[model samples]
Target: MKVFVYGTLMQNHRANFLLSRQKYIGPGEIYGFSLYKVSNWYPGVVPREGDRVKGEIYELIHEAEKTLTRLDDYEGEGSLYQRILTKAVDQKGEEHEVFVYVYNGTVDEEKYIPYEQQPWRG
Candidate 1:
C-alpha cells in the first residue's frame, strides 16, 4: 500500500522513527493538501492554492496493514485526522493516490506553521 506522510515522518524527523521500522519503498510528495501543527506534532489536510504540504510517500508491504492502522489510531484518525485518499508523488517522480491522515475541523488554523521550521525531539 502507498502512504503519504508529511510532518515528523519526513526523513529523520521524530515520527520517522516509527516509519523506519516498516518497509518503506521510497520518498515523495502530495499536492492539493497542506500540513499543520496539532499540539507538538503535525497533521495535514486538503489544500487551497496558497497552501503546500510537502512530504514523502512510502510503499508498504502488504502484510503491514495492521501496523499502518495502528499509526492511524495513534494519529487520532477519527478526531484530529481523517484518513483520506489523495494524490501523492514518489521519489521516482510518480504520482498516485494514497491514504493520508488529514486534520479535522477541531484544529485552529492560526496555530500551525510549516513542519520544516519546527524543532525536533529525540
Candidate 2:
C-alpha cells in the first residue's frame, strides 16, 4: 500500500521513525486540497478547489497491514483524522492512488499556515 505524507512524516521530520522502513517512491503533490498546520504539531489537508499540497509517497513493502494499523492510531483515524484514498501526482507527472490522513475536526482559520511557508516544521 502507498501513503502520501506532507508533514511530520516527511523526510527528516519527527514522525519519520514510522516511515523509515518503507520504500520512498518520491516527491508527490495532491491537487484540489489545501494543507494547514494544526497547533504547530502536524498538518491537516482539506478539500479546496485549485489548491495543492506537496508531500512524499511511501510504499509499504513487508508489513503493510501492521504498519497501517500503527499509522491509523498515530493519525487518530476515525476521530481527529480520516484515512482516505486519493490521487497524487508524482514529480514525473504520473498519478497514484494513495492513502492520506485528512483532518476531520473543526479547523481554526487563524492557525492555517500558507503554502509558501509549508511542510510544517513541527
Candidate 3:
C-alpha cells in the first residue's frame, strides 16, 4: 500500500532512520495537503483543497502495514494521531489516495505554527 508521510518521517529526518530499517517499497512525493506544526512538538498534515503538503510517498512492502500499525500505535495512534485515508498530490501534480495520520484529541490549533514556522528541526 502507498502511504504519505510528512512531519518527522520526511526522507531526511531522524524518523527516516526507523523507516529505512523497514520493508518499504519506494519513496516519492505527495501533495494536496496542508502541513502544520502542533504544540511545537509534532507535525500534522490535513487534506485540503488548494493546499499542498510536500512529503514523501512510501510503498509498504510485504506485510509492512502491520509494522506501520505498530509504529502508529507507538506514536499514540487513535489518540494523538488518527490514521485516515486522504488524497495526496505529487510534485508532478498527480493525485492519489493514501493512508496518513493526523493529530487528534485536544490539540490547540491556535498554538499550531504553520508548517513553514515549525520550530523542531528534528
Candidate 4:
C-alpha cells in the first residue's frame, strides 16, 4: 500500500526511521489541504480549498504495512490525527490515491504554513 508522508515521516526528517525500509515513490502533493504547525515536534494538516501540501510517497511491504497501526498509536489517531484515503499528484504529474494522515484538531490561523514551506520543519 502507498502512503503520503508530509512531516516527521518525510525523507531526511528526524522521524523518518519509521519508514526507512519502505520504498520511496518520490515526491508528491495532495491538494485541498493546508499545513499547520501543530506543535514544536510536528505539524498537522486540514482540508482547505485551493491549498496543497507537498510530501513524499512510500510503498509499504506487507510486513512493514502492519507498522501503520503502531504509527497510528504514535500519532494519536483518534485525536491528533486521522488516516484517510486521498488523491495526490506525483512529480511526474501522475495522480495516485494513497493514505495520508490529517490533523484532527482545531486549526490556528497563526500556525498556518504556506504550501511552498510545507513538510513542517520545527
lDDT for each of the candidates? 0.67, 0.87, 0.62, 0.86
Error at 35, model 4, angstroms: 0.2
Clashes of each: 2, 0, 1, 0
lDDT tens per residue, model 2, 41-118? 677988889888888999998699999999999999999999999999898999999999999977778877666776
Task: Supply the global lDDT for candidate 1.
Answer: 0.67
Q: After superposition, how far is residue 84 of candidate 3 from its true place, in Å?
A: 0.6
lDDT of 4 by residue, 28-59 (tens): 99999999988888898899999999999888
Ranking by lDDT: 2, 4, 1, 3
lDDT for 42 in candidate 2 is: 77
Query: How many angstroms is residue 19 displaced in model 2 relative to the true structure, after the best TM-score fit?
Result: 1.0
Task: Give the number of the best model, judged by lDDT.
Answer: 2
* Candidate 3 per-residue lDDT over residues 35-122, each given as its tens digit: 5666555677655556555566676764687768766865678778888877666656666667788667444556544545532344
Better candidate by lDDT, 1 or 2: 2
User: For model 3, what is the alpha-carbon lDDT of residue 29?
Assistant: 45
Output the worst ten-in-a-row residue range by lDDT, candidate 2.
113-122
Candidate 1: the clashing residue pairs are: 27-91, 28-57
What is candidate 1's lDDT per residue for 1-122, written digit by digit as tens?
77777766668776676676665656566665555555654555545555556666776664578868877877788887788888876667778778888877755678555546433231
Off by over 4 Å in 2: none
| Candidate no. 3 TM-score | 0.70
